[model samples]
Target chain A: METREMTCINCPLGCLLTVTKDNGKVTVTGNTCPRGEDYGIKEMTDPRRTVTSTVRVKNGSAVKVPVKTKTDIPKDKIFEVMDVIRKAEVKPPVHIGDIIVDDIAGTGVPLVATKDVE
Target chain B: MYCRETDVVIIGGGPAGLAAALAVKAAGVESVLILERDTQLGGILNQCIHNGFGLHTFKEELTGPEYAARFIKRVLDEKIEYMLETMVVDLKSDRTVVAMNRKEGLFSIKAGAVVLAMGCRERPRGALGIPGFRPAGIFTAGTAQRFVNVEGIMPGSEVVILGSGDIGLIMARRMTLEGAHVKLVAELMPYSGGLKRNIAQCLNDYNIPLKLSHTVVDIKGKERVEGVTIAEVDERLKPIPGTEEFYPCDTLLLSCGLIPENELSGSAGVALSPVTGGAVVDNTLETSIPGVFACGNVLHVHDLVDYVSEEAENAGRGAAEYVKGQKAGIVPEDDTVMEMKAGKGVRYTVPAKIRPATVKKDVLVRFRVDNNYKDVSIGVFYDGRLERSVKKRTVAPGEMEELRIRKEELDKYPEVKEITIGFVE
Candidate 1:
């Protein structure tokens, strides 16, 4: 059996969660809500994060436009996603929610613009 | 000097100002004008490009810019008047505003009501008093954020962050994602000043070490930063000898704390709270000057922009009520004005004083804990009796806590003169 402790990030409350793994069974303790249990189970298995960064803009009001993954991606794919976004640029009249990169870092998450540039 | 007249004049274009303007207009006030110092409407939210905004306002997670855009679109749709690059140089208690801009050389506005939403400024290195040479590599966390997120410029290739506030924690991850090696984040306090979610997602997930009870003791460099020497601090927050360690970095970011920008408020003869550093407002969000209102960061630093919008709405509604010369409720002179006091284990509370007549439904008193506490209850005491108490598993100085006092409850204590909020273990 293995045990790990982590702070649940699902909400601002930030309940401390203790996850214990034995063979194929997982038990989470010290959580105030069920979301903490789900977060613990996922942390023990597959951890994910939503990546937010800026992309270069051309012929726009600003020099850069901030972008973020529409959903949480695999934790390890953050740098890879950054690499793709670093080399990417968008044109003027770009609206918020515009797709900047499709399926970023092969995480099946689309990078969308978070600001409107005209 | 050019002169104009308006029913209401808001002194900012940020989330607070925008929400206030919308509420003022919705309250049947016409000719509302917003004066913005920046070239755009979003204010700081434009540079805060990170997500995690609007969860309470929009019911969906959004980036700072996205959240601002939602409000901006509403302002435009509502046809509210606003001037970009306009700076309010002087504000008087009589609702006279003196402003200037390139387009409008000098002008003044006689407003029926004024809403101060100038927001807050981050505490800089000058305030920290760290023994360091004046170096170009040092930047406030918000300035660095603007550089990376807006200007597309990297502050440095290697970074060391001082103060584990949310901005510092966010920038640590940002600099790392942009290929900078963030050596570590050293915080002076025993506990982090940032939200727990930020510490977990921005620092823990990035594998960045957060050294609490540590602070920068020395800075090495002449023209630019070469390195920083950090040392562990004792219980008194004094540096302990022989615990010094040096880390080489080209950049250092400070995210200590935010101070409410109230110079304009002071100039307007608005009484300020030493603890909040903002205006001393009543339950209606009106300052000592009857027609003047304040909200958002300019009134008190808030953890969430959603709360800022809500508070600004209250200010806007109050200002509109003042302009219309009618209030929702009448105050009886016999009822004593109640003072909100911060008791043990708690910091200051907003709405420093409340007049029983101003509360139509309920009044929300928000405050922060003085220290990190576990398994505690927040007790609200009126006069000498415990009126209400709430149990919390944990509370920290970094997060703001709130409690609602219904009007019916206050009606029961008409002669109550003081309300104390304290922690009950």
Candidate 2:
């Protein structure tokens, strides 16, 4: 039996959640929303987070352009994803939602520009 | 001096100015001008490269720049006239705006209506007044953000942040992602000033400790930051005698608070609210100076930029109405004004006054609470009597609260002079 206390990041109203796992069965308490229970379950299994970072820009108006993963990636893969992003560079006319890196760090998630760098 | 005329002149070319310009054009006002001091149009949003913006306005999560780009695109598509790198130095209550740019040395604009959307500035280290040696590595979170996200320069390798504001929290994660070790986050108040989700994603995700009720009492270093000494505070917010702990770091980030940029509004003789540090506005967002309107962070600090856009749109529509009303010779009566007051458990409310007749459909009253509350009911009182109350699961000072009063609601109580919003047991 294992128990862990955490705050649900699903919404602004962060509900303090108590997740109890006993023999593969997980029970979440103190959650106001069902998403909190899902979060608790996901935390017990595989934690995921949407990573946002700045990629260097070449010949763009700004020196760097902000980019984010298309979807949430495994939490443990953040450093690897950042490593790929740090080395990546792009040119001007980069629009928002433009793919900067495909299959970033083997996460199968493409990194998209969050800002226009023109 | 070069001179021009416009129906409305909006100060600042950020999200507020962009949205206001679009709204003004939508209201059939042709001559609208936006003055931006920055070389670009997006203002601070260009530097804020994080996602989680525009959930309300765009109905989807967007980064700060992306959110601003949407409105910027709209303003451009609408063919709104705007001047970049043009600073509005002086604004008169008579709608005379003195501005300057590289191309135009000095110029004046006769505006029928003006919108104040100067935004806000981060509180500096000098404002906090911690006893410390002058150091080089100390930077406000926003400045550091501009350095890293915009200029592609790392401020430091190690950081100790003071204040649990959203900027500080975001920077903690940002610095960490860039290989900097964020030691800890110390906040003065027992409760965090940032959103709860930030605490979870920014701090908790990185295993950064958030020490609430703790503050930096001393900063140690000569030319560069060496360390910071944090101490736990008592109920009165005074540091305890022996609760000092030293943290060795290369940088100390300050995310204390934000102050509304209202110097131009003040110079224009707009009535300023002591609590909000912004202009005292009516329901139409018109300042006491009549034709001048205020919105966005220049009106009050907002956690969400979507609200800033929404509020600025209201100000824009109001400015458009003012310009059209003047041409039609339609004047509003002063007797229809209703005063708004903040009762117990509420800190302050925006739109300090409301003219029931001027409110088109609904009057949106936004406010902040004095402290944290659980399972509380927010009561809207009319002349000291509870007229409407809504139950809230939780309310905190960090999150802004809003209550909408329909035009018919005010018509029911015609004799009511004052409306107060507060927490009820």
Candidate 3:
């Protein structure tokens, strides 16, 4: 069993949290709000974060309007996910929140809009 | 005058207003109206093409437009009435908003409670005290974003962002991808004012240089921005003499900071907090005025849109409760009051004053520090007398920290008249 001290990043409070793991089970404590609890579990069991960056665009003066995965992806697959996003090209007249990738790398994190581009 | 009478009237049809209206409906008060100045319901979010919102409440990453669409759809589904192209020119003391728009020359609405969510405005070059002749190339970050995202216009080929705030950082990456040569992102502060992720993804990933402890001392141009003089600053914030350098750029994008849109609130005769330059409110988010509530960017600059939604909902719920006669206003029972000051290394704390009745156990006292301090203890004092201390491994002035004193712990401090929060090494 191993123990870790972390801060919950879900809210502005930045609550000091403790997470303990034995075998494969995880336990989290010391969060003030519900969002903190969710963040703690995600941090302990399966940490995932939505990746946002730019992608190659077609037929536009500006290259990017910022794009991000719609869902959280596994911690390790971020670079692989970006490679795919960088290679893919979206035609102009894209509205904000238009889904680019439904399930990127099968991580279930859909690539979505960050800014509108036309 | 076409007067729309309602219990609560909200201004600015953004996510804040949408959330506020939804919260009002959830609280069992339905006579709510949201007035928008734009042709559509969504405000700035329509142009904010980036993702980074709706992570907490929705548990999914959504673009600005997508996030606003969710609430706007919900507001429509709930039958929340709103007016488009409605610009409120005058708000009266009796809670009436007088507006003039294209379709209608004049209209009025009498509201029992008002939620001001006008959001904020970006700081421009003039606000930064940069010595320069007025030129055509200088633009605020928001204007640049709108030009690029909405109108599909490239503001410039060479860009130098004046502030390392989120907007500036985001623009740096944007201009680069747009085939523009972005020279640098200059910031007056040593540390970035934007989120850590923004600094990483926007600048670092793009190899865009970030110049810290720097300032644009002078701007030189005739018809358009030709070049700018940059200088390094000392601890006192005065530009050092020999550290002056010049960078040639056709465009200067200022993302210095954001100011709360509090003109209407000021006109309403509401008390303002000098620290945040926003309306002061109790726990209920109600302004000093009997039935006026303020939230979102109009109240204070928020780091995340999620917090803005949460606060706007609080204001909406509070307004609903007030209109329903569910909440009774009263002078705090404990006549004793303590003036809370952000002692050394602290920027400011909200409310500024605390009453025993309004002080709750687990009170979330949010305050910012003046500098980054490692191994610091936040000390709470009662009128110069030490009460309690919470130790922190690391704390920064850029980030707001909240310290909680349980109701049980608060009960012990009976003689407390005023509380002061400060940091020490």
Candidate 4:
């Protein structure tokens, strides 16, 4: 059996979770929220995150409009994900909520503009 | 739809916005409007069911909603104009905000000065890299608080906490009182991030053990949270071997930390300070943008709600004062902003940019250290000369450190352009 201790990031309660694995079965204990189970398993296996940052713009008075990934992506693909966003550029007079990168890295998460760039 | 114009348009109807509204009223700005995304005026305070708030400003014990109500009631008494269920969809420097609601399908408000009091948001599991099976037993501290206090729902029978922040500490007792067997409140930090009073009242009062220098290393479950593993950590925060222990439970709550909600501010071309993850503001709480101001958790992660209220009032009044042409008219003196960096046991400081003499307000530098210490003094240096000093009140990396530089003391450094603050023997 393999066991591990983890902090449940599901809530402000920050429940300490105990994970015990026997053969192929996994058991999670110690959490006050329902999301802790999902958090723990994903954290142990394939971790992902929703990256939020800015992308360069062309012929725009403003430097950049802050953007974020609409969906979480695999942790290993963060740098590759950001690289695609950095290489991309757009024109000015763009409205807020404009999609900068759609289906980025096949995460199906669109990088949307947080503000207008004119 | 009714169209309106104001000198200042504040977002988020929480205590921060309410305090800002009152400050604008005090500054004689009649054309001020507050747009709240929530139907209730009190914001999240309405869901917080515990006490241990209002220590600095009120010198009395109060609950979250009660503390927020103080400002909300004042906003009503002041007759501050506000719109409920209004979500600001678009904000632009041209002084316009595209807001929408059920009552008002689509509307716009124009203002000269804008205050961002959107407050801070809880960092969720997705932010933390925890491997686990997708189940229904995980929740955030704020979400649990809402469920327990507002919806009267008991999340689980057995629980364990991961962070030792004030919220996590408070929830330890809250969950216990709600008839849950709380195993432990583990923190990666050596000391607690919550106030001293919370440690005694919340964890200690309930016989709940708080394990320091501990972290959750692993999790397990298929349908629900079946268990969690905790381990001691070394100086680098890497988990140490031979110290792992498994605790069985059905749920987990996360209170790691709160991040400032700056998507809107960052989008509006507002510069942010890495220390607090908020905006760089001058003494008047005005951002780099001439007519923009910020306060509350949106400005920085505050230790108390009282401080948030204080800053909101300052931001509100600053916007009002600027609209009235009474705020600081001097430019930043060409990047003459002071910088405060933590030393040996220090971490980060806020208000990343300090505009000298912009206002007569007493300057207080608030920061957090990197570790726990005894008998230390925080020193402020201007060009290698001692400028101000404050005695330590048991400085800990978990708790924020506040150092005051009186107006007169700051005035002494007439030629000082930049300053650095740190702690020394």
Listed models, DockQ each: 0.82, 0.74, 0.14, 0.01
Query: Weakest 10 consecutive residues, lDDT, candidate 1 chain A?
Result: A8-17
Off by over 4 Å in 4: A1-118, B1-3, B326-345
- Worst lDDT 10-window in candidate 1 chain B: B326-335
Give the fraction of native contacts in model 3.
0.10
Index of the highest-DockQ prediction: 1
Model 3 lDDT per residue over A1-118, tens place: 9888776655444567788888988777877777767777777788776666665567764465557776678866876786677577788777656888788887876887655557
Instruction: Write down the lDDT that model 2 would get.
Output: 0.92
* DockQ of candidate 3 compared with the true complex: 0.14
Clashes of 2: 0
Q: In model 2, what lDDT does residue B251 have?
A: 96
Candidate number that wins on lDDT, 1 or 2: 2
Residue B335 in candidate 3, Cα distance off native in Å: 8.5
Q: How close is each model in CA RMSD to the real structure? A: 1.8, 1.7, 6.3, 18.4
Using all chains and alpha carbons, the TM-scores for the candidates as numbered come to 0.97, 0.96, 0.79, 0.74
Docking class of 3: incorrect
Cα lDDT tens digits for candidate 4, B1-425: 55667788998898789888899989888888899987678777666545545766687645565577677768888888898988988777666777898987888887879999998988898887777776778888888877775554679988989888878877787677556889999888777777655665467646799998898888778888998999998988889999999999998898889999988787678888776788887777878787889888888787777778877888888898778773445444444556545554666666555666464667666677777777687788776667667676457665566776566655677566666677754
Candidate ranking (lDDT, best to worst): 2, 1, 3, 4
Model 3 lDDT per residue over B195-238, tens place: 65577557865678898999899998989999889999998778
lDDT for position B99 in model 4: 86
Q: Find the number of clashing residue pairs for candidate 4.
A: 69
Q: Interface RMSD, candidate 2?
A: 1.3
